[model samples]
Target: MAANNITSTHPAFFLLMGIPGLEHLHLWMSIPFCLAYTLALLGNCTLLFIIQADAALHEPMYLFLAMLATIDLVLSSSTLPKMLALFWFKDQEINFYACLVQMFFLHSFSIMESAVLLAMAFDRYVAICKPLHYTTVLTGSLITKIGMAAVARAVTLMTPLPFLLRRFHYCRGPAIAHCYCEHMAVVRLACGDTRFNNIYGIAVAMFIVVLDLLFVILSYIFILREVLQLTSQEARYKAFGTCVSHIGAILAFYTPVVISSVMHRVARRAAPHVHVLFANFYMLFPPMVNPIIYGVKTKQIRERVLGLILRKDV
Candidate 1:
């Protein structure tokens, strides 16, 4: 039998430790997490409603924003509710299969989010660098294709993770020191060799992050070059203005991910709660802030949001 009295080769369930070393503070932590989840729901739903109802927002940029909003909603929903459940009520037991499902959604949606951000960068690049070709380059049909491709790519890459995990025997124990079924954390609880799971997870993460970051950077460089070539200061300013929201979205989404990943790898001796907090931040911050960034920086979205609030057209 395992140290925790778990004897089966594969436990039927696992217990989630909301945040190791922070059990006493779980109630306090739930407050912020609850607020973040509520805000994400309100913001993303409103954003989706506005984009869908307004014919003027049928353009590629707004369409991509809608896609991003959808992803944020799903991505946040997959983790936050369960986390809040664990924190608020101490309901931490999750069925083994359910854990795998949650892991799939979490990882798959994250990949899709990265891909959509890359697509949004391309949209901005074409809109600025090749203004005349924007319409021809990113047609409605093409946008649909891009969205589908992103989903397919994420599914293809993440589909094997649960299967691989299922093949292992979890003799270490049933307790996972994470709020959600994070790949590495779960892998660590298995008795079998975890080198492949470790390497595969890291490789997939790097493949998506590095490639998407490279493309985003390259797109921005060309955008800067094109903006600089403009003779009018106002023209350059206006061109740059359109990208502010996307830039904010990128930073909000990627910064937590990179920080959490680095800390996981290098800060092994750091406080356990610190690592858990960063992981939670990666899931919570982006979804909660993405709509605010867009609503504040994108004039169309801002105006529509204000209009909805004031019950009058701006």
Candidate 2:
């Protein structure tokens, strides 16, 4: 069995590659990375500031948006600094334990973000389908509980990942062939029976993603049905309009992810660069685009952001 090849100790450092065949492009690559990070930070921070400062934005929808911004900040911050270091300074040597820490935060935040999206879907459902219970159902106490539950669920599910990794014997020298310390990327280097690690990773990922996707789809189905039954065209349009930002958020959040996962799992013959490209997009695209999409598509956020620029209270 592959488990028999396990060693007790791992190398002190793992060298991360910016891009294997494209090391020459690392500097160039940092441009987009920097742009994504900057936009993600600036946009998410502005959204957070506007949401928190304006009392009128304190409803369930905005509260979920605030949570989303916080998650984006945490998610992007978890990896971008190290990635920039890798690209700009050729600082490829990541401490082994520190890599585990990075993995924990990255995966936990990802799962947490999915949970938040699911909650947002529920918020939209309540607002559109059961307007009478919208405010009463998503009370402060309920939202707090949802927030706590989301955090707890992510932490609980992801906590075991590092420990599972710790037991593996990584005899495959210090180099990780990608820009960051992703779970499958790191574990693939270990020269042991990685079956358990691979299976558990897939199981955990599918567990979260499937449930999140199912609930999100179900909520929207109910929402669409309700919108159709509304008598007036304007009322239907208004109901659907409220969900545009959420729909954008869902697509922004899931598109790259689904692509990446499909490439990794289904298209095993995909080019190495293809995998890397999707991986980068998976991490960077959602965070950078979510805030901008909300700003452009959600009237309240758009107005508030413009108001801030014009030095007028909204």
Candidate 3:
């Protein structure tokens, strides 16, 4: 037990932390966390089901909505289950390979989510700006290709990441600071120089998520310009209304991350729990809120979900 106090020079397995200083609050913390996870699973699943089951929703917008829901599900599952295990069962021991696997899935799916959002922005741009060519621009075949390309891009970018970690010497003990196996968190545990991992990780993240954000911003700029050019107030309102849900999703997906990043800088001296709250939000909030953002904001999805519930009760 005394020897265990010394940090390992080469940790074979990683121990994930729940909420470091707030271990006593882990159970209480898990209530909201479990609720968020459950909602994420149920909401995304329901959105997918609603989108797929309703033949009335076979448009490009709704199809893209389905893609977002799928990405949200994949992204949430990558971290939440393992996180819940840590919080509840206290099963923190993860083999080195498994941690690598989780890291890959988490990063890959996050990139995929960004890519999908970019594709959706393109979908909206083509739809609202060039309605005449909307059908031609975003056919079912094109949508399939976009989905495949997004997945391929993420996989290709992430393939080298785990291998990069394999070369490092993790002198620090197995305990990871966060509930999940984040690229930075895992890399930070390494004793050897990790400049390459740091550089590659930051570069890939910026290239993927940041580039997608830039494109999304450009798309919205074009969208807003197009909406403003509409001849009638009603037309302008209608055009902009279609984009409200997408904007909500964009905000939900990105805000927590930006907030967490800001918190990192501004709250360095703050309590660990403050960081833990943001970290959990960064991981959990988007998936939990995306479906709600889409479902409640998109009239079609909202009506369909309500109709389904009514029919089930009847």
Evaluate all candidate structures by whole-model CA lDDT and list the values in order: 0.93, 0.90, 0.85
In model 2, which range of ten residues has the least summed lDDT? 1-10
- What would the per-residue lDDT of candidate 2 be over residues 9-44, giving only the tens digit for each residue? 677888998677888999999999999999999999
**Candidate 2 global CA lDDT score:** 0.90
Flag regions of model 3 displaced more than 4 Å. 1-10
Ranking, lDDT, top scorer first: 1, 2, 3
Residue 124 local lDDT, model 1: 97
| Prediction 3 global C-alpha lDDT | 0.85
State TM-scores per candidate.
0.96, 0.96, 0.93
Error of 1 at 291 (Å): 0.4
Candidate 3 residue-wise lDDT, 69-177, digit = tens: 8888888888888887887888888888899998898888888888888888898899899999999889999999999999999999999988888767677778888
State how far residue 83 of model 2 sits from its true place (Å). 0.7
125-233, model 1: which lDDT tens digit per residue? Answer: 9999999999999999999999999999999999999999887889788999999999888999998578999999999999999999999999999999999999999
Q: Give per-candidate clash totals.
A: 0, 1, 0
Candidate 1 clash pair list: none
